[model samples]
Target chain A: MYVAVKGGERAIDAAHAWLAEERRGDASVAELSVPQIREQLKLAVNRVMAEGSLYDPDLAALAIKQSRGDLIEAIFLIRAYRTTLPRFGGSVPIDTGAMTCDRRVSATFKDAPGGQMLGPTFDYTHRLLDFKLAAEGEVPAAAEVEAGTAQTPHIMSFLDREGLIQPETDSDTTPPDLTRTPLELPATRDLRLQALARGDEGFILGMAYSTQRGYARNHAFVAELRIGTVAVEMDIPELGFAIEIGEIDVTECETVNQFQGSKTQPPQFTRGYGLVFGMSERKAISMALVDRALRWKELGEDNLGAPAQDEEFVLYHADNIQATGFLEHIKLPHYVDFQSELELIRKLRREAEANNAAPSESAGASGGNLSGKMKEGAAE
Target chain B: MNEKTDPNAARKAWLSLLARCSAADLDALWTDAALDPDHTVLRTPEVGSVMVRGRAGAVGSAFNLGEMTVTRTSVRLASGEDGHGYVQGRDKVKATRAALIDALMQTAEADAIRAAVLTPLQAGMEQTRATRSAKATATKVDFFTMVRGED
Candidate 1:
């Protein structure tokens, strides 16, 4: 039985006081403001926003400051804060086709419609540390050119025209919200995508890497990856039509996987899609690969007993908040439970010793019997 | 003439503009315009979130992408016009001012408000977009193929 324990109030208060002082960290150093974190450390803010499933950079920055740069802890703070706000409503699906392209690239095409733009990427940069960044220095302004007037079309649409890729059917039916309801097994593609979008980036990336290593390998090619800002709109009952509520930056990845077909059907390329908040291209791409791997069952491909193919395993462990909570809870006081186990172990040892002393009297009650009893007690 | 054909279209345009305008810009514009009409808060500014949705493959069924912070409110002017504001982030004052501007846009003083507030805000928004677009445009790659000596 669990017993109520008290008397840590004063100690706990003192500990917190000391923690706050430590969090301030060398008062001589200039303090980091929330705005500075939001603006300068934007990639960190994006990760928190994507994982925390909330898109307020200021709050994410504040959480980062409070957590002293522990991203998971910052995500936890954002998640907790999210529950307090009243949800106004769901926005109408954002039109990514109309997105103002910042960085758009395709691996399948040499020159896709609205030509490849490598906006603010670090792909080609040498890994050598830029010591100049340590000191304040003025950087040159980014060069500018006249904006292109041509439309930037989705590369997959080109394949769709030739019936080369599997066509995704449009649906107006409302999707089941994972947040509103507990996640059940055999989750639909929409639900799986929702979970994976906010899933832990590192976990998803690992799962994706596993797939690339021939674990349920679906020869995936990044059809396109684009990052840009899109307007968010919602239909207002009072206004009688939809209006642009706001705009948010997002990264979208589309992967074209190897074809799947039977005797009755012609071969067509399968697809996996990922859309996430902010410029989280890595997370977005990983999500697409993992998403494709999870679709083996639906796509009529054999399940290779891969971890990524197991939807339950991926979705269950992908949430770092839940994982960290359960894992860290063990460090908390379990005095009663541990004491019971200790007493059980001592009792078993005493019984074994008694059996050893009286072996002639109880020849049938051997060390094996004592071990079996100990196992049962441990189970209890 | 466009407004006459679709009466709500103009309001929609101005509301969209107001929602995208920076809070600082709106505050400055509000003060410079020197416009303060008697108004009642039909609903006080409340900070909340709206679940943003996106389509699968940019064409298929919609799924929840995430939630974004938004502040919204409804206000009615003494002249009986009601206006609603929904702007990004948790700026309560911006929401209130936006609602006031929205209401003012429907009144006889709309042209004056448009000149003093909405026009400048639209220009600022356009300038920001143009600058980003220009920078992105500069990054466009012009791939060239090299021919072998034998070929």
Candidate 2:
């Protein structure tokens, strides 16, 4: 049994004061503002929003400042804060097809419609550090051309037209929300996507990499990866129509994977999709690969017994918040539990020593008795 | 009438414009517009969240993407128009201002409000979008094929 102990109030308050001082980090230095963090460290803010599952850049920035740039801690802060707010309602599913494209690229097609634009990418940049940035060197304004008015269609649509890829159908059924409902095994695709979208970037990246390295190998090609802003609309019951509530930046990746066909069906390419908040191309691409890997059963492909293919393993361990919470809880006061374990071990050792000292007077009887006591200690 | 001319469409456009514009910009426009329509707070300005959803493959069944922070309020102008404000982020003041502007738009002052507030907000949004889009367009690839000597 765990016993609650009190009387650290004074020490705890003092420690918190010390922590506050440490957080300030020398009064002489100019303090970091939340707006500065939001504008400058945008990628960090994005990650917090994605992982925290809350998209308020300002709040995310504040959390970052409060957590001293520890992203997971910032996410924890945002998540804890999220529980206090009332939920307004669900938005109409965002239309990515209508996204105002910032960066659009395709590996499959050489000249896809809405031509390949590598807007603000780090893809081909040399890894060498530019020391000039340390001096806060000013960057020249980017070259400009007239923005295209034509719609940039999804690359998958081309394959869909030719019947090259497996078709997907839309359903009106409301998807199961992981936030509101408990996650069950053998989760639907909707649930899986939701989990993968907010899953830890490093974990998802590793899992996606495993697939590329021939773990449940789905020969995937980046059909397209686009980063842009899409309008978020919601239908107000009183208004009788949907209105654009806000716009959010998102990165979408679609992977065309290798074909799987049975006797009755023609061989057609399968798809893996990923969409995430902000300019998170790496995470989006990784999520798509992992998503495709997990579609083994639905695609009628044999399960290769890969880690990525294990839904339970991926879903259970994907949430960093839950993982860190449980992992960090062990560091808390386990004094009572530890004391009980210590006592049991000591009792076992004492009994064994006594049995050894007794010289086996009743060798079999005493030995069995000692062994029984040891087993009892272990059980305790 | 087309979407642009429809009253509902006009409200949608203005509401969207209000939501999309920066909070600072909106505050400036709101103050300058001087649209203080006496209104009852049907719903006091409150902060909340809306679960955003996305489709798998951008074509399939929808899945919850995540939640975005939204602040909303409802107001009824003394002139007998009900207006609601739902905007992104946690600015209670902005939400109240939006609701006031929304209510004001329904009154005869819509033309003046549109000219003063909505027009400027639209221009600002367009400028931002055009600037970003132009930069992206500049990065569009211009691939060329090389001919062999034999050709």
Candidate 3:
């Protein structure tokens, strides 16, 4: 007789109680608020917003706090909450070209139209220990300038003017929404980009790194990276004009990959694109690289069989929620299967020893024959 | 194109203004109008969310950034004019009022609604923008360099 493991609910409740205590960590330290996370731990909030595909900073901060700063857990919380909300009609595509840039830079040109404004960045900061930050930190106010009226010209535009880069045809077709539909094989560029946008940041980063390290090596150069706010507009059918609805912060990345001329075409630079919510340049750049690598088929490049190049492999495993669920489920009970395997291995060992000791004796015995038949049936 | 002759263009501007107006402003406009407009709720005010998307590099393919809370409603005027309203945030009353205004604008009440609701809302929005810009300008700094006599 077997008694199954019970009291799981009570055990889970106790574990949760302990977890709450552990999350608090220290009594003297003050509790962190949602506003603090939203303002100070802004990058973490941005990541949750980007991967979760939801934009509310306040809700993202709350999720971060509830998940105890585990970003993937926060993203999972956001995604779960997002699915429950009713859908409103979609806004018209935002004009990124008209974005009021706060931080815009280009690596492709020596001096671009928008003079490389290195707005608040950690790129130049020395990674030295700051003991002052551990106690009470004070930040000096950054210099201010009138917000520029001119839209920062894209670096790729210059390349396009020279006929050096491939030109993309304007598309009027509505892209498929993965949230509404089941993911099918051979996803469109739009669908692939959507998966990469909300994909696990670290997983996409690793895949991008693999491409740089000889697998589907595309020799990517950062053509342009811009972080700014753009106005959202919705077209009213009754009224002939579209009107501005709201504004949101976004980060956009465009990478110019290696140039090549196919048999019929002239040499032209290819492009990789990435766009994410808030100021997440790293994710944007990584997404762009991975995006370009996945476009190998459309570009008529040979299938180098790179992980980044495999659309099915990348899109299917990109979602952290699904990946984590499958990974964590191994902790569940499997004792029955383990016990069966154990018995079979023991029986096999016994048979081998019996055959070695007295092969003819075992072969002639009716009892041995019956047992052997039962073992064979069990194996089958 | 003259806005006077273009009813569609003028209506769009008014609708957009209503969508952007604060809940209090919308209410004040409604009360101040003193128009006992008869209307039926075709669709009850519903609170929902929209997944806002952005194009990569502004011209590339679109990607979802996040969701924003919105309230929407539809109403029909007694005269059979239909109107709809969609606004950011979770204000049901504001959304309903907007829909009412939308319907009335299409009916014979267009001029009266323009004078009562649209004008005040537009003024309020412009004031808000001006105040924000003025505050932002106070912190503006311009960098310049002077040539020295030594040079």
lDDT (C-alpha, whole model) for all candidates: 0.89, 0.89, 0.78
Score chain B of candidate 1 by TM-score. 0.94
Ranking by lDDT: 1, 2, 3
Candidate number that wins on TM-score, 1 or 3: 1
lDDT of 1 by residue, A1-380 (tens): 54556657999999999989998999999999999999999999999999999998999999999999999999999999998999989999888988898999999998899999999998899988999999999999999998968889899999999999989888977777887898999998889998998899999999999999999899889999999989898877888987888889999999999998889889999999989888999999999999999999889899899999999999999999999999998876666676667668767877896878854555345655655654444422
Which TM-score values does chain B get in all models? Answer: 0.94, 0.92, 0.87
lDDT of 3: 0.78
Best by lDDT: 1
List pairs with backbone clashes in candidate 2: none
DockQ, prediction 2:
0.85
Which pairs clash in model 1? none
Scored by DockQ, the top model is 2
lDDT of 1 by residue, B33-127 (tens): 88788999999999999898888878999888889999999999999999999899999999988899899888999999999999999999989
Q: Write the per-residue lDDT of candidate 2 for residues A1-380, one digit (tens) a residue.
A: 54555667899999999988898899998899999999999999999999999899999999999988899999999889888889988888888888999999999998899899999988899989988887866789899999777679999999999998999889867789998889998999999999999999999999999999989999899999999999999988878877888999999999999997879889999999999998899999999999999899998888889999999999899999999999998977766566567568767866896878764455345445655554443322
Model 3 segments more than 4 A misplaced: A1-6, A24-28, A135-138, A236-242, A356-380, B1-42, B54-57, B60-68, B74-84, B89-151
Q: What is the RMSD of candidate 1?
A: 4.4
